[model samples]
Target: MLTSDTDAYYSPGHVAQVVAQTVERSRLKSVIDSHCGRGALLDAVEKSFPKIHCAGIDLDGNAISHLRKIRPHWTLVRGDSLAWTAWERIHRKLGGSVDVAVLNPPFSMGQVKGVNIELEGRVLRGSLAMAHVITTIYHSNPTRVVAVLPESTMFSEMDRQGRAELERLYDVEVVAQFKSSTFRGARANSLLVGMTRRKRQRAASSVEKAHYMSLHNAIVRGGLPCFEAVSLRHGVPFVHSTDIKDLVRGEAKESLRTVRPFTRGIVNGHMILLPRVGVPNKANIGAWFTEDDVQLSDCVIALQYRSERIAHAAAVNLRRDYEALASLYRGTGARYVTVGRLSEWLTNARNTRTYAQL
Candidate 1:
């Protein structure tokens, strides 16, 4: 029974179970909830680790008061987590960072000005509640962090920059996706993420690759550009997965044209053009080695490659490892492969090539 605006949704029992399991595995000594509504999460944590120290923070005084009466021994504070001052005081009172942090912060967008939380290499920037909670948890410098967030947070437009920052700084150990129906009264799906704090660096050997990075680091740049479609009279050469198949079979170039002032420039043949959504089939995996450049539609993405050898190797590896690549799709709609998913596959290719070279 967390109280927020109409957009707010409380944690479901399954999400709590996931968080509790993460806490147990990490063997955390202390836990804190940044947006503990009605203390449902704290209750779950206390049940698992009976003697572990706990604290709760919420914007609703009544919610805080109600929880305090039942668990007076725990420190429950009422404050806006988006503000740095509140966390500063909380840190001083706790005397140090908590061992684990479980948060289900509000989901909303607004400018959070004048607050800078340092991560391993960069600062997360956004006006979203999710961004604030993530930065706040990072500021606390906790050893482990588990949060339940909307599925869109996986690769949504609004949280792209912040998500990139988090990926760069932390090791995302788990991303368990569940349908929105999992929540008693919600309509949008969500993800339970398990992240642990560590210094950012590449693996020293192949054995440590999974620990240091996922397949995502291999994607240099990707996005489905948006632009008005026009007739061939104003068109330039355009490419689709079908056109790529024709090229592969030694067929003449299909006449395709796009409007002038295209959103994305024609990508070189060295880079791979993949349908942003598909069944992970050979025809769907578009690897181009064209003499001239061509523009791509919003339905596809240009996976920029740094080396020609790397690009060629990725195409071959993707064909053989299509099953593994299929597992990277994010949403349930049309089997769309997000930038994060594509990057994961590319990273695998790069790592394999690097190891082969050695």
Candidate 2:
């Protein structure tokens, strides 16, 4: 049985070697593995940098006992790595110089078995284990930090907030994203990021802005009108994803039929829509908005914006960048834009620059 009690999925030996090789380039005297499961990472670091002192922390007692017996010389401690006491102990034993910290935190949400780790001189909130791990290590003021995190952490609202807090304490150097397959059984993609503490102050205008999150936490509510709700009466205009490009180019024909005044799929002027599904060679990835209220068919997804101005702006910019938007299409023959993935992609798009300028 290839199973372990710790959420500690041991890193493949080759992967551990890669981390060791990457760290070898930097000038460092001490290294800490916040969640060192079975010493997979520590072993590689020791083989490559024989002189560098190492420390390992883990919540699993079995893992700690196993590692301690195998590598008796290491400073292996069994405790919540996010705890202030753990950090203080590690820092003291390493002569107050934690040069580099390698972390592969548990990919979990919520408190770890109701354990609260002290952070920023106080008990940390939230159950996001990755956030806690990074925070604890960063607060220790290591010279360099390398962490493996979920890809959604780059764009998800909650993870973005965690990243924001991290930036307030350090400067991120690289965010290398890799496919989900990089880690076995990983449902989402992951990011191997490197960051260091910010050393100086800068003018407010010179600061690099965080990614615009207009669509990051945007709610995607959709509806498909029933036969009765969609009629040729004096109600609301009916729209489709196929009409989005034409509508943006000001070449769309008037909707032939109208839906009920308060139809289920009816959306106000301040809303965007993409096909719930799209076909190949179809320009269906763009967003659409109009000053007129409209109802959509079941095949469309309606994203309501906070205001009409934002919706119109997003539509225009999305049109100008149609090629990029089209690239979001998924599936083989009957392809479509995935709402969740599209939302993440939109946050990193230049079209959302309006939010950044603000």
- lDDT of candidate 1 over 1-358, digit per residue (tens): 2223523467777678777877644355678888887877777888888877788777788888988898888877888766666677678778668877887777543333323444567674443555655766665767777877765455343454455555544666545666657666666556678877667543335323342223222332223244454545555566654555565455554455554435343454455666666654675453455556566666666654445565566667667767776777657567777665554344344544632221
C-alpha RMSD of each candidate structure in angstroms: 8.0, 9.1
Best by TM-score: 1
Q: Rate the local accuracy (lDDT) of all candidates.
A: 0.60, 0.60
Once model 1 is optimally superposed onto the true structure by TM-score, how far is the C-alpha of residue 115 displaced, in angstroms? 12
Write one digit per residue (lDDT tens) for candidate 2, span 203-296: 3233323322233234343444444454756766766556565654555436435666542355544455666677423344334556566666
lDDT at 288, model 1: 50
- Candidate 2 Cα deviation (angstroms), residue 71: 1.3
Which regions of candidate 2 fall more than 4 Å away from where they truly are?
1-6, 95-97, 110-129, 201-358
Worst 10 residues of 2 by lDDT: 208-217
